[model samples]
Target: MDDDENLPRKTNDPLAALVKQDLDPLSVDELDERISALKSEINRCEAKKSFAVSHRASAENLFKK
Candidate 1:
C-alpha cells in the first residue's frame, strides 16, 4: 500500500470548505441554512442555561426555608 493510503483522512469542515473554494461561491440559501442551524444551536444552549439557573434558584430557596 502507498504511504498516502496509510495517512489518516481529515474531517470535513463545511465552513472552511466553503471559504477555501473560490470557483463555486456559497449561495444566499446556503448562508440562510447556516444561520438557521446556528440559531437552533443557540436556542439549545440558552435552554440549558435557563434550566441550570432555575435549578439553582430552587436549591437556594430550599436552603433558605
Candidate 2:
C-alpha cells in the first residue's frame, strides 16, 4: 500500500486545500496573482486585529472610569 493512502484526505477547509496546492503547474503570472491576493488578505486581517485591540482598550477604559 502507498504511504500516502494512510494519510488523511483533504478537508473542507479552503485554506488547507490552498496550502496543499501543487504550485509547480502554475504559471509565473498565476503565482504573482496568488501572492498579491495573499498580501491583500494579510492586510485585511491586520486591520481587523488592530480594530479589535483598540475596541477592547476603549471598552476597558470606559469601565475603569
Candidate 3:
C-alpha cells in the first residue's frame, strides 16, 4: 500500500497560470494546440466580459428611470 496514493490531485488550470508552464519539452503540434486552446479561451472570456458589461448597463438604465 503506497502512502502517496491517498493524496488528492490538482487539476485546476486557469489560463493565466498556464504562462508559467514548462514548454521546453513540447513538440510543434503540442505548441500549436496550446495556441489554439488559448485563442478559444480568450474569445470565450471576451464574450463573457461583453455580456457582463451589457447587463451592468441595463441595470444602470433601469435604476436611472
- Report, for every candidate in turn, its global Cα lDDT versus the true structure: 0.79, 0.93, 0.86
Q: Candidate 1 on 1-65: residue-level lDDT in tens?
A: 78876765565956457446563465989778877987898899999999999999999999998
Candidate 1 residue 49 Cα shift, in angstroms, is 0.9
Cα lDDT tens digits for candidate 3, 1-65: 79966875456745436766899999999999999998999899999999999999999999999
Best by TM-score: 2
TM-score rank order: 2, 3, 1
- Candidates 2 and 3 compared: the better one by lDDT is 2
TM-score of each: 0.58, 0.78, 0.74
Model 3: residues with Cα > 4 Å off, grouped in runs: 1-16
Q: Per-residue lDDT for 25-57 in model 2, tens only?
A: 999999999999999999999999999999999
lDDT of 2: 0.93
Cα TM-score of candidate 1: 0.58
Question: What lDDT would candidate 3 get against the real structure?
Answer: 0.86
